[model samples]
Target: MTMQRRQFLGTMAAAGAVLGAPAVFGQAKPRVVVIGGGAGGATCARYIARDSEGAIDVILVEPSEVYYTCFFSNLYLGGFRDFESLGHRYDKLASDHGITLARDMAAGVDRDAGTVTLAGGEMLFYDRLVIAPGIDFADGSVPGWDLSKAEIMPHAYKAGPQTQLLKAQVEAMPEGGTFCMIAPPNPYRCPPGPYERISMVAHLLTQANPSAKILLVDPKEKYSKQGLFEEGWQRHYSGMITRIGPDFGGDKVEVRPEAMEVVIDGEVERVDVCNVIPGQRAGAIAEAAGVTDDTGWVPVNPHSMASRADPKVFVLGDASAQGDMPKSGFAANSQAKVAAMVIRAELSGSKAFPAKYSNTCWSLIATDDGVKVGASYEATDEKIASVDSFISQTGEDAALRKATYEESLGWYAGITADIFG
Candidate 1:
């Protein structure tokens, strides 16, 4: 699936007397098309516009009028943030930064014709393409899950309607009922995300319905910051939260939407509210474009972010299976800047300096505090690997808890600036 027709052409292009072998040979301000302006595409568009010296025509394709990043949406769910705070306008990305914004989804890619077809039936020709369209649920990965009834038990992974749907269910949860969270296995986006979400929601339920319980149905035996997370949960929530791991209860979901029961071990555990975050795969667009890996993530050159299938394309963020680097808004924003620099060098007929990268992800453990993970990295033969890292060491005092709380907002602000502000 990975070997492409361009390998021979690329080899000849490298061997021949071409002034520029890697980038567009003679195009001025290479017209680049970017899909999904959420975390990766928006940041990439902004950087290309900000630093490309007007030698790149940046066009962003997105369907949403405003984007609410999934990373910070937990804050909104915790009642710490107004819904308005999470909304980001694309006008700044389009108007201030000179990026051409398209409000439509990419429907098809005619690579040989250098065109990307839009959901509206418009054909956009590009000198180069960057796809950061994020992930999609593997259709019916579990027996009871399907598009027809995703409305009943929302994933909240998309962070808009899913957010609202899940919120309504949480509010409607009976005073002493159960709320369950089904966490997908490893290689999923935002490794530490769902646990942090359950933590925040559990905190909310502590007040709204003190007798409420949270059941975490996890596929994996362990999770990101497994030790730290459990420590925090036990200290704060204790009996309020219970997790079922692979060995004891197993992770498979035999979903029965009509009855609202997720079967495990031949038993039906009906819940007042269910949040099933199923196994994920690259957005179908990546697969359709023929850039996906065996695991359904895009394969790109670690250094250039160039697709192994089409060198003219660069894939970033959650859509690309960049190991070690968690699929996160911060990571996407960081990679966006790097991809911009590499594309800039290609446009200028120069090579980008050895790529060095950084990422920090902050998740709200509760309204009072947040836990963080951060790392600096460089590309390796296989993928972008980390050089330095930090994880939350137990929060010691009230002042430190306050500090962690404020730090999440600061990180969100700084990352928003990096991407769209």
Candidate 2:
């Protein structure tokens, strides 16, 4: 066996031996099984391991060997970044932090038994569990569209092969052909994501197919960074974009992927390329764990990010329904640190402090033109309440916008290192 595989197997065996033993017996260190290796799970595993000082055995179960971030994925579509640049591996998480990497999907969670069954059929017992599987599209959210139709109409929301497929389709569009985007509703992953994608697509079209048009079908009447994006669109690519909101039947729409058509209020429109971002819910594992509510997201205690249903299980990132936090990578990363601290304190007798969270979402409107919105939050009895907020103002000078864009680049580097290493 490879050295890494042997190490992982050894860790699993050790954990299995202590499945019925109490930590008070001091036979084995407490074990934490984190499902998902995105910003939330990776950060949580690293912090729990590093802070516990080997007092906790951290096992991260993730199917993907290399994680591609959804935050800057729009830049990849715009040709601002290469696909490889968005991918991050887990080697450092394993080697530097002594985290056990189980490259397997979590198929089931037995809350009563405190065990997680992997797709490969290995059952892992955990003293504590963290689920941060991120977002999954809701079935039947869009008529005539499903996962099977994804090949024809790419969503590109998860930031991997779908992203590459969407970008390729955009680049291959016929000159002056129309491109359509079906934006998702509220409470979806990355509130500003679809808009940022629209801006990126516009950037690409302006350069290669100047005559091409963009059709934005949005269900909501307003969106994140609306004024700023509208100003940028007008200034950068005037007369090249059109938007249909709820009043104009954007909310009542269906797609015929086979025919390359979008039906809005019974009006049929043909497009060369279609990007369909359907409504989304917590990743499936959350539901399997019985933590999610009717809203299809796990309600977390604002104080510790522990699931309201089961305190032993904590939910983070897009899978959690923490109040006032948008489902963005930055928010997920921030929530993960808080959860890690709390989990360590609970299991390892370490000091725990009040939980504070913050999030900022930055979007690139054009070359070196960026905008942002963010807020600071604190845990309250009812929810994670927002304390203060800020947003990039419209009509900013080129120098300021360029500086904002540069700041985002630095943030990407810092956050990725913070997450992976």
Candidate 3:
């Protein structure tokens, strides 16, 4: 499936030129300034540069030189992958793809002037802008938690130093200690991420501290892949995990980070380590651009991912409030391709194809035990509607589970190359 998708993307790129050469707009080439070089932005930049064949200039604004993927960071925590393996550099994008890399944060956006201001005080004027800044924690969503308290109760959602911190904290935990996780609400990045992290942590503790307990305080009534995760947890690490849902006062929770305690409905439970995944909103730059609505997400046209607020501005990935698509890297990559096609057609007069998107999220439960859920989607008048779907069944055999795990490995390599190169 991974190889086929890569080939399809390549075919789309080549088929774009069948319409003829681009129509030049002015003396200088039409420039696209892409903000936040993650799955969506990076893939969009690469596709536009590759497909447009120098008709358009692409500039990527991102603060990080090495991007660590959140998708497989849980595997790193489980010791399946090393930290360095999760990191990817944009050298190929700049050296080979002719993309200009601005290693600085995007300070603000002037939609009226079609300019993006960087933290370094450089202003980039663009014919089009793509915003894919991923996610930011919503302020005060967790009553007693904030960015400052992240060191104590690390979110580790962004997948960098905080991930290492959480791993270290988990490793240094006292024998039979409690590890508490305050899972986020719905619409968070990677719908099944927290549960995967729980499985990985359980994997670690099962080896090092078999008596250690995992306490999950989740506000959501149900979560992504609940049946699969519960079944795997029972099979692999029995008697080690406990989950508290809203019915059990999980929704009414607060944390005392300094004291390493969780307060659930006025009852305090002392914990050795805490992982607080808070409610999230679009990245700050999107809100600063005045594109985000009251829900703190940028709504976009289903056909092209162009911001509804401003057609020239496109929003992708976690920042976008497109319907039915979970905020996953694969979904972002799929959306990026559609947006890149539309942008190329609009700016460079390439052949535009109908927008089609697909996403599959693969998660590992234990060593060689993997499961997946995914769907194919298409642009409709109202939203990106799912057309077909598939999921791994609960009672799958060991061989099938291992094959799923191997398939995920292939996907990671294929996708990272597709995005960065």
Candidate 4:
């Protein structure tokens, strides 16, 4: 179900062939307005701004000045790395790539008028629009769970303030304190992200307070890298890790912040730290723009990523419903590249050839050891199917594990360079 990193590059090489010879078309550069400067939006902005030379005016709207990657953020929360390491600057995207970075959220979109409104009431028009605002939690799904409760329990999955709050709670916990984690339903961002987090926290507690344990409430029977994660836990903190599954009692996952307790089925919660990775919907911007269907996700063409409802607007990353692909940072970054290339060709009056996309997500199970999964995608009438994938072995090999750790840094550096420079 997953593709490995090495196989992804090979698939891309083959993809260019099936796409036929690249066609050349002549046209003036068109202005691009990109909303959300996360992995997907930022990468698209940089490529359009740079490849179009001085012809294209790229404006990027993002509320935050700096982006903290969600890929290895668990390491920071576990105390294995500093927060600064995950933070990235946008100077290259602005000064070097000539992208006009707007430091505000896109309040509304007037599709009929072809204009977008900023939170400050500023209006901007674009020849083309790219929406990649990441994800928003389904706050209505669970009863009595809202932003206020999120402030207390801290989902840290978003990789910003939540990450800091979780770290602080862990640091202040008593030696024998229990840490509770509530996993969301299937089809969410970073499928293996939560398990990797548990692995890192177990590693940290082994040093800081070995008596502490993690109480996991999983909505599904099995999850991404389930076998590998269980093997690592057995070798590391087998007894300290107690997992509750749907059959065993995972259905009881719910929380009350005022009581500072989470109920499992009908049981009272008792934990010093808590994290609930809630179910997710599309980003609020997508809903406001009326691009989402009942599921709150935009529908798009599998090849060009053009919205089915709106041709001038393209949806990428977690915001779009890309069949069979996980909602992941790497996937978003990869999708951005493909979407940008298609837009480039479209603006030049050239036809969009069938393009292939691939993504690999690396999760650090410990300081020197990491696990990864990846997949390659191709367009079809039914849906996108996996071309290839790879996964790390259960028990780590001395050489391979070390290479994965190095590869993680290489990935971060490469993606950052591709997006910013």
| Top-scoring candidate (TM-score) | 2
Candidate 2 lDDT score relative to the true structure = 0.92
The runs of at least 3 residues in candidate 2 whose Cα sits more than 4 Å from the true structure, single-residue gaps closed, are 1-15, 18-24
CA-RMSD of model 2: 1.8
Cα-lDDT of candidate 1: 0.78
**TM-score of candidate 3 versus the correct structure, residues matched by position:** 0.94
**Candidate 4 local lDDT, 1-421, one digit each (tens):** 1112334234425753311122222433466889998889999888777766756667787878778888779888777689988888787888887777666789998777777787865566677789998888987544446767877788787888888888888877898999888888876889999999899888878888899989998879899989888987887687999999999679766787777687888788778888878888888988888889988788888777778778888888988886877888888888888788788776755455686888888887766777788889886655556788888888768678779978988988888777667
| Model 3, span 142-171: residue lDDT tens | 989999999999999999999999999999
Q: How displaced is residue 355 in candidate 3, in Å?
A: 0.4
- Give the lowest summed-lDDT range of ten residues in model 4: 16-25
Best by lDDT: 2
In candidate 4, the residue pairs with backbone N, CA or C atoms under 3 Å apart (3 or more residues apart, or in different chains) clash, namely 3-374, 3-375, 3-389, 3-390, 4-389, 4-390, 252-265
TM-score of 2: 0.97
Residue 96 Cα positional deviation in candidate 3, in Å, after optimal superposition: 0.8
* Backbone collisions counted per model: 0, 0, 0, 7
Candidate with better lDDT, 2 vs 3:
2
